[model samples]
Target: MKKLKIGIIGCGSIAKHRHMPEYHASSGAVIAAVCDINEERANVFAGLYGAEVYTDYRELLANKDIDAVSVCTPNYLHAPISAAALNAGKHVLCEKPMATSMEEAKDMIEAASKNGKKLMIAHNQRFVPSHKKAKELIAEGEAGKIYSFRTVFGHGGPEGWSADGKESWFFKKNQAFIGAMGDLGVHKTDLLRYLLGEEFTEVGAFVETSAKIDADVDDTAVCVLKTESGVIGTLAASWSYVSKEDNSTIIYGEKAILRLEDDPVHSLIVQYANDDTVKYELGGIQTNEEGGQKNSGVIDHFLESILNEQEPAIPGSEGMKSLQVILAALEASETKQIVRIN
Candidate 1:
C-alpha cells in the first residue's frame, strides 16, 4: 500500500501534541507538509517531521503530492480549510466542533460529497479506552436501560494548552467561537451520542465567562440535553477547573451506574443497584498535563479508512449532528428557550 502523504494545517498545540506526532508514528502515513500562519511554528514542525512548511494552508492544500490533510486550526477555520482541502481532492480529518455554524458544517459535508473525498471529524473521545468500553456495555444492554448521564470535560484553560499560551486564539470569541462548549462540551455531546447510539433532539444551556478574566468567550457552560430516545443528560464544560482536570462521565441506568475516567486507578467503574461492583482498569483519559498521554487513534482511523476505501466511523454528517447539539445549546442560552434540533 502506498503511504498516505498527510499535510497538517495549523501547527498549534493540538497539531504539535496530537495530530503531527500521531501521524509521524503511523506506519501508513507520512507527514508531507505542515502549515500555520505563524511560519516559525510551522517551520518547527517541518524540521521535526522532515516535511515542507507553509504559512498559508491553501498553499499546502494545493500540493498535489499531499493525499490528505488534518485541520488542526481554530474552530472558525475548520470548515473553510477542510472544505477547501476536500475540494482540492484531499481527504480531511478535521478537529472538532466541526464548524462554527451549522451552515459551514453542511458546506463541509457537501464539499466532501461533491469531491468524492473523505471527511472525518477528530472527535477522539470515541477512541478512548474507557469511553469505548462504556459504549459497548451500553450497546449490549449491560447497563440495562440508561436513565440519565452527566459528563464533564474541564481543565485549567486553553492558556495552559495552546501554543501561544495565554494569548491563544481559544480565548477570542471570533476565533474559538463558543469557548469551553466547543472545546470540551462538544466532545461529551459526541461521546454520549456514540455511546447511546442516539441523537440529541433538544438542548437548554447556561453559558458564562465568569472564570477567565478578560476572555471574550465563555469559560464555563452547562447544557441539558435530551436524546431522541428520551435519554436526558447534563453536560458541563469548563475552563475553570484550576485544581485538577475532570474528564469524567456517569451513566445511570436501571441495572447499574457506569463511572468513566473518574478514578485514579480504574478508568471505568460499574456499581449495580444490588451492591455488586465491577472495576475496569482500561487507562487514564488523555490530557495535556506534564506527562499526559496524547495519542487518541484519530490519525490511524483516518488513514485506515482511506487505505481501505471505507467511510470514516465519524463522518461529516455524524460530526454535524454533534455540532448541532452545541449550536442549539448556544441558541438556548441566548434566547432563554429550549432549542430543538431540526
Candidate 2:
C-alpha cells in the first residue's frame, strides 16, 4: 500500500505529541510536510521526519504531493484551515473544539462535502480505553437505562502542556475563544454523545473566569445538560485544579452505576443494584502529565478512513453536533437561562 503523504499545520504541543509521532510511526502514512509560524519549530519537526518545511500554512497547503493534513492550530483556526485543506483536495484531521463558532463548523463541513474529502475531529476521549469499555458495557445492558451522569475534566491549566508556557494562545480570547469550555468541555460533550448515542437537547451553565485572572477567557465552566432521551447530567471543565487533574465520569443507571477513570487502580467499575461490584483495569486515560503520551488511535483511524474510503468515525458533521452542545452552554451562561439545542 502506498503511504499517504500528510502535512502538519501548527507544529505545537498537540502536533508534537499526538499527530506527528503517530503519523510518523504509521506504515500507512508519512509526514511529508510541516508548517508553523515559527520557522525554527517547523524546521525541527521537518528535519525529524525528513519532510518539507513551511512558515506559512497556505504554502504548505499548496503542495501537490500532500494528500492530507492535521490542523493543530489554535481553536479559532480549526475551521478556516480545515476548510482550506479540504478545498485543496486534501483530507483533514482537525484538532477539537473543531471550531469556535457554529457557522465556521458548518463551513468546514460544507467544504469537505463539496471537495469529496474526509474531515475528522481529534476528540481523543472517544479513543480512551475506559471510555470505549464503558460504551460497550452500556450498550450491553450493564448500565441499564442510564438516568444521569457527572463528567469532569479539570487540570492545573495549559501553561505546562502548551509549547509556550504561560504565554500560549490558550489564554487569549481571540485565539482560544472559550478557554477551558472549548479545550476540555467539548471533549466530554463529544464523549457523552458517543457513549449515549443521543444528542444534547438543553443546557444551563455557569461559565466564568474564576481562575487565571490575567487571561481574557473563561477558566471554569459547569453545565447542566439534558439529552434527547430525557437523561440529565452535569459537565464541568476547569483549569483551576491547582494540584491534580480530575478526568472522571460517573453514570447512574437503573441496574448499576458505572464509574470511569475515577479510580487509580481500576479504570472502570460497575456497582450493581444488588450490591455487587465489578472492576476493569482497561488502561489509564491520557493526560498532560509526564509519560502521558499514550497512542490516541486518532491519527491511525484518520489514515484508515482515507485509505479505505470509509466515512470517518467523527466527521465534520459529528464534530458540529458536539460543538453545538458547547455553543448552547455558552449561550446559557450568557443569558442565565436554559438554552435548548435545536
Candidate whose lDDT is highest: 2
- State the lDDT of candidate 2 residue by residue for 1-342, as single tens digits: 899999999999999988988998899999999999999999999899999999988999999999999999998899999999999999999999999888999999999999999999999999899999999999999888999999999999999899998999999999998899999999999999998989999999999999899999999999999998999999999999998799999999999999999999899999999999999999789888853578889999999999999999999999999999999999999999999999
Instruction: Quantify all predictions' global Cα lDDT against the true fold.
Output: 0.92, 0.94
Per-residue lDDT for 96 in model 2?
Answer: 93
Q: Taking the tens digit of each residue's C-alpha lDDT, what string does model 1 give over 1-342?
A: 689999999888888888888888889999999998889888888899999989988888889999999999988899999999999999999999999988999999999999999999999999999999998998899989899999999999988888888888999998988899999999999999999998888999999999988899999999999988899989999999998899999999999999999998999999998999999998788887853346788889999999999999999999999999998999999999999998
Query: Best candidate, TM-score-wise?
Result: 2
Residue pairs clashing, model 2: none
- The global Cα lDDT (0 to 1) of model 2 is 0.94
